[model samples]
Target: MAEQTQVHREQAGINAAAVRSAETAESTQQRLPRCRKLLFQFEVDMYAKIKTERLSFIRHNQTRLRADDYIYLHDAVADDRNANRLGNMVILPSSFTSCPRYMHERTQDAMTYVRHYCRPDLFITFTCNSKWDEISNELLPGQQSYDRHDVVARVFHLKLKQLMDYITTGAIFGAVRCHIYTIEWQKRGLPNAHILTWLWFHVPSTGSMWPAKQWFTLHERRFPIHARHPTVQHLSVHLENGQRVYFTEANLQQQLQEPRDTTLTAFFKLCTLDDFARTLLYCQLPAYYTFDASTKCWKRRVQGSSVPDHPGIYQTDALARVYTVHPNNRECFFLRIILHHVVGPVSFHHLRTVEGHVCATFHETCRRLGLLKDDAQWREALEEAATVRSPA
Candidate 1:
């Protein structure tokens, strides 16, 4: 009996030791860092390549213009420049402008008059979808489901940081003052963004510079229609007080109002996870122009066009063009943002139009100025211009 009791005790001790070892192993597995797992699951090298491609697109297009031009247009104005130009440049408002007191009063009166004659029905609906489920099957098999929105938001964050870094590094240097607001929106099934921006600059006084006629004259131009309007016109005027004020109008109503708290607003402020996702999209997925080997030139790829019911990317008739990357496939990430449709006070006479006329003119001008050699590509670029579409 003594021997039997001793044997039983030994067996219990072994069992306990085995249980403790198993528990320790389980805990270690649970507590392991996820970095290695994620690295193994997703092709980190491929992701890095994607990031490189995105950055390359920005560098390619942005570098085509003089750095001074970008800095002058996109940065803050120096005080000296402001003083010399007599403050003929002012910041423009964004898309979220509301009615002023006078306009509000007029609107109220008009509503009261119309309300008595007609009744309108109003309705609102809310919809939601899981980002993971929407994109899971699109990912490689055995790959973990990551949120597409989140990935885009992360990309934007990185891009913003890079832009800031570039500015600080003196890669972009100028005297103009500017502010940018990135807004994101995902309501119902639609998800997109708006970048509310303000810029203040000064033009050197040549005595012939007239604020009212030469400066304040806003021209009808085409701009990107990210949200509502397809085109916009922007202008600025010098006031008697030596301050320049800018404005934008569409259909007799101002579209550039004060910035509002849209999804993009929240994202820039880091107020919500949704914003982070948007930031990612902005940084990672900015549209760019890519060289089409088959076409033997650059072309624009629409984002997310592979999705059902998506309208393919359209070419414009305007001089300046904004290109975007097609969101559906990774191969066509470098898309162009044709600036032709953009509405602003500045004349796009220098920009090449798709109709090939402006480009031909530019090439001739460059030749006259001894700036460019007569190359075959110039003719090719001109031949491609006839395809741009003007806004109706």
Candidate 2:
């Protein structure tokens, strides 16, 4: 290309020195005509000049240009996390792409895929095999597979493309709804593709060992979740005050409010008139009844919801789970304990009741039940430390 360009430059009666070769551009050293290397520099210079001209125009026409804050990391970063106070933070903008920030951005973006398609069903790896006939056949007599990096790269690229086609076209994993893949170079300079395929929720006729429906069935049989209903959904516990509200932000345009009725409140209302409900524990609610989210209530299910053979029995395949509470939250931890032993609590205060006495606090209620261990050892250790050791 340089020889052809030089031919045209000569025809146009342009000076040989005009489009400078490496010899003219740098007096230090020039082994060969560096037009190929100089071509890269020419592009870089042209881009910078264009940017400089635009900035000059924008500055002159400040009134015409729409104003906004501009933060550019052209040469380097301008911000650091209190580097002077702690220590030096030498990381620059160029390094940021491979830094933790870049990794974090990619990981968060990966979650959006998981959320949309549910979790991935298959994890696949396509590593470049050095022994492939395509790469091995093209090698010279004495040369190894790694001798020609170009050949290895080209062959791997083509193979990866074909593999991707098979997955995306629903040929490999039957009816693959979607797939996510990433390519990485190993230490041997060979590329490999990591793939995650979200399979369609149908069992195919052939060439499929792990379709979504079959996978779920196998797992559910091995690890049943209490009892399986026809379907399960988010249920509101209205009697637990403000339990349904998620405080995601400190301020809102309008105050958030939940509906007045929920499963817990509905149960209390039901127990007032039904002796059966009063006898049932909170955890057993779903096994006996189905939640009506639209009405914010629980209704008796038709017979055979669980026990299909019996027509007179009231049983269901579903069971409502009283979720375990983290011990860090004292009140909730205490409440969960009482819910396990108590049946059909009408109110939060009722859960705190021990035997016949209405306790003032949930903590005191658990203590009365002998659920909380005494902290005499810890208390004595701290008291001794206070007298013996300095505050620091």
Which candidate wins on lDDT? 2
Q: What is the lDDT of candidate 2?
A: 0.52
Backbone Cα, N, C clashes tallied per candidate: 60, 0
List TM-score per model, in order.
0.18, 0.34
For candidate 2, write residues 269-289 as lDDT tens digits.
766765667778776777677
lDDT of each: 0.29, 0.52
Candidate 2, run of 10 with poorest lDDT: 216-225
lDDT score for residue 69 of model 2: 13
Model 2 regions lying over 4 Å from their true place: 1-240, 245-259, 305-313, 373-392
Model 1, 291-341: lDDT tens per residue?
233433333444323423434533321111222223342222211111212
151 Cα displacement, candidate 2 (Å): 33
| Overall local distance difference test of candidate 1 | 0.29
